[model samples]
Target: MMQHCNKMLHHYIQQSHSNVTIKEIIPGKLQGRIASPTSKSYAQRALAAALLVPESAHPAGWSELRRMGLCNDTSAALDAIQRLGASVRYGDNRDTYYIEGGFLRQAPAELHIGESGLSARLFTPIAAQSPTPITITGHGSILRRPVAASMVAPLRRLGATVTDGANGCLPLTVSGPLRGGTVEVDGSLSSQFITGLLMASPLSEAETRLLVRQPRSLPYLAMTLEVLRTFGIEVTHAPDYTEFVIPGRQQYRPTVCSIEGDWSGASCLLVGGAIASELRGAGIIVENLNPRSLQADRAIITALERAGAILASSGHLWTVGRPATLRSFEFDATDCPDLFPALVALAAFCSGTTVLRGTNRLTHKESDRAATLATEFAKLGVEIDLSTPDTMAIRGISTSDGSLTVRDPRLDSHNDHRIAMATAVAALRADRPVTITHAEAVEKSYPHFWDDLDTLYTA
Candidate 1:
């Protein structure tokens, strides 16, 4: 099985048939709109929460999730939930996942999370609820990222003995019927661990008060809270997002829920549209995004506006037109670290220098995002200075003539979905066709990304 999974990753990497070579984005009107994929983050969170619901709450309504993207991450989340003893089925529409709630009878030998960092971290505490010792592991790039002291420390605090395979990474062994009580989790590393704790706390033998010191990605935590509330699990947190108090032994009411369009994935499309609009004098329309979503990447609109793109939203459809003159802007990405790559792509065509903060958060991703973005964009002649660890100053060049100053360069995606997508978007204004290797990495988040990019073109 391990060999087979490795073969699959190799197949995805060597899929040059899927490599996208962009010479230019034709100057034309974008015809049909791209309905964004379902939020993988939301789907995973919902599935985790659903696993904690009692068996009596059978036949919960989960809508539009099973069909939205089917990326490896979301698929891993589904598989993880199943291992935890939830019976999941697809509706006739083939989009909604109907999950029958229950707890595990016996722990699986190993929970394969499949390169999804969220699934590995978020499900660890969930799996710890079992009396049986379980080994949590994953495949691909996730193996290199740390499980962090934040995760292991708190599990230990909750009465679980946690052990990691050297240097605090994957293949972690956790044993617990976690008797939750007041625990302090250092949230500066990543908020997903806290989210895991929150989702698993309600099932603990005692009330859980989670005190977080300096939480990052606050919006993602807010997103977790919103999903918890939808399933009738309440978590009370402070205004600054420092503390969360969860009442123990609370039941997760079986929910009838549909996932909203993903702002994270949609932000890539939205930025692509903004850059494409510059070439074609067209107002690109993107569907299925809520203007009021709590997602941090939803701030892409604000970034566009700052860069002088004409932008507006009517319900779910958002329109962005290129500005006559693109200007450099400053953005603090502390809460929205995922947007760094897309923002880097957008800033490449903006004039002068664009400064993006929160570079500190990029190190622990699938790849070191800051270094990867800087390396890949430099191939396209964009100068990125990361002298200060916490900030990145991108010196943008004028591509107003719809031609990149740099010659055609072969770019590598470093096996990151966002890097591949961001580089593709940046190629829109390039003087020559850009060739990208490992382009199929988008399957981790957006499986049909190439299909969506193909649709944006009109003869």
Candidate 2:
């Protein structure tokens, strides 16, 4: 089984060698309707939940989720599941994945998470449920990230022997059948830690009481609960999202679940529409966008409105157009840090200076996002100042008439997907064609991002 997982890992490695470069985007009126991809965030969560419950017991249609195309992160979780004794098979549909779970027996020697923050963080605690010693590791940008003592501290408190690697990154070995107990998790760094514990708590030997401190990304926790409920797992928590209670020895009943559209990825498309609408009279209509999605990036709408973009929504369909006048606005992105890039892109087109708060969380992502955004946008002649540790001010360059000061510049993605997508969106209003290197990085979340952008532009 480990050998099979190694093969899968090699396949992914071979696939990543292909690189793509984006030529300068034509500034114009963009028009078209495109549905965002199923949320990898949601899909990864559901896949984790499914691993805890066997297929025979799950609800009908649950197998359909297996048929969907797997993202790099989702693929990692699935491969890890197989290594942990579960059998994954394809249905007659050939696309649907049917996982016969509950077989967690011989824990593999190692589990590899490839550039998936969610997979690495969320799967670690869950994998500890097996008494066998297993090491958790990952690839690329994930290696540079600090696993931090906080991530393993809660598990250690719960009776798991965890040893971090020399660099304190991956290859952390855990020996446990995590015996749940009262534990405190520092939630400031990431909510993924809390999410991992919540997913695995029900299977613990004792009821679990998890107290979280200063939890950010609360929406992601809400989404975790939603997915847990879908799989017949119950957890009690406060409205403030500070604490959670889970019954011991609880069973997870699997059910059919579908991954929803991703607002994080859609924010890029919407911003592109807003910028393009300014150039061409045509507006962009985005489909599969859930107005009530638990994603933090849904706040993009607020940022757009604040920047004076005209938005109209009916059900799941949303349209964005340039406002008669765009102005700088102040936004606090502390709760939704993923919106920083898209907000920055929109801010570049506005007439005045825009202030975006919540720079603290940017350093731990795929890249030093805050620094990367500032450096990359500077090439386009936009000035971004990180005046304080947690605030970024974007001084928009525009003529007195409020038209964007577009210029021909080449930007680098720094191997960050959001940065690549954000740079492309900002290009919509550029004075000349903008070239973005390492544009293929967008595949980390949105594989069809360039395709969708081309669709909207050519339509």
Candidate 3:
């Protein structure tokens, strides 16, 4: 696996297939329309299916195993499926995945998460379900990434033994009976850890209860619930995620499922459209997003509107074009840390400055997102101050022209996909070429990100 890591990491960059980096972005106010890629948030649902469902009849696997969208991030999820003893073969005419399920046996010797935090964090509790020991590892910026400490204590209580990197971090090893029971978790951190446990428990012998304390991003939990139901697993949650009941021995039904397009990645396009809408006479149009989606990143619409972008929706199609004038709007990113980069890009167009709170949670992301945002923006003539560990204040550049060279040539990915894409977007606004050293990190979610963005809007 380590060899695969070394090969994959070097393969993309050295071979110039890390995908294309934007040489320069002349922001003349983009006057075109574009559609975002399939949702990774939805794609992982298929992975969970492949893990728990079997392809046979007479109570074979999860019933909803059908054709689904294949995106870069979801491909990582499918890879995790392959490692867990499941057979994944795609249809020649269709990207359908035929998963032979029931892989609750011993885990692989070592589980490598690549550069995907979603795959890393979500797969942790799933790995704990096994009686045999599993070693979880990743490459790129993963070693420095912070997974919520909330994941540790519960698996311990469940009788699933675990260990972390130097400090509640990765390269974790866990051996478990995974005895299910009530445990406390902090919602203030990423909701993924708790979501992992919720999804893992039905396969356990004992029923489980999860009590969330800080619960910052609750919407993601809701999405997890939706997936659980879709996969034929049953979990009941009280109003606020205060309590969750995951029944044991629930049979997973096999059926096909479709993944949604990502609202998170679409944010960049929306911001670009909003910034240029006034000059172009129309904004951006996005499809397949649930107006009531559990993804906190869906809140981009609110942020765009607050910043004075005119937003109107027809059916599931959402449009964010030109705004009369973009203004600074303060955002509290306590719940959706993933939105920080797109929000920062959006805030740059505002007058005055924008301050985002809850930046303390960024250390675990692809880059130390707060620091990364500050550093990248500074190179473009935007200044950011980290007053609190979790808060950032950015002064906007009313006007920026010409190339803005990134100060540090060898920038770290922090193994977070959003950071990689965020830096690329930042480059699109500059005059000179914005070359990202390890740009392949974008594959953790949006594989065609640069391809799509470059089509209508050139950098």
Best by TM-score: 1
Residue lDDT tens for model 2, 130-246: 788878888888888886456777889998889887666877888788888899888887898789899988989899999989999999999999999887888999998899999
Give the poorly placed runs of model 3, Cα more than 4 Å off. 1-29, 54-59, 62-72, 92-94, 277-280, 400-416, 426-433
Ranking of predictions according to TM-score: 1, 2, 3
> Which 10 consecutive residues of model 1 have the lowest summed lDDT?
1-10
> Per-residue lDDT of 1-459 in model 1, one digit per residue for the tens?
111121111112343465533222322323457788888988899888777778776454332244445788999988888887887878888777877777684468689999888888898998888788889999878888886445888898888878767677888988788898888988887889988898998988898999999999998999999989988887898999999999888888777677778888877788877776534466577888888888888988889989987787899888877666678999999999999999998888788999999999999898999999999999888999999869999998855564466554778888889998888777766665566777768889988776677677543
Better of 1 and 2 by lDDT: 1
RMSD of 1: 4.9
Q: What TM-score does prediction 3 earn?
A: 0.86
Instruction: Report the Cα lDDT for candidate 1.
Output: 0.79
Show how many residue pairs clash in every candidate, following the order shown: 1, 9, 41
- On lDDT, the candidate that comes out on top is 1
How far residue 363's Cα lies from its native spot in candidate 3, in Å, is 2.0
Stretches of candidate 2 off by over 4 Å are 1-24, 55-69, 90-95, 103-106, 278-282, 400-408
What is the alpha-carbon lDDT for the whole of candidate 2?
Answer: 0.78
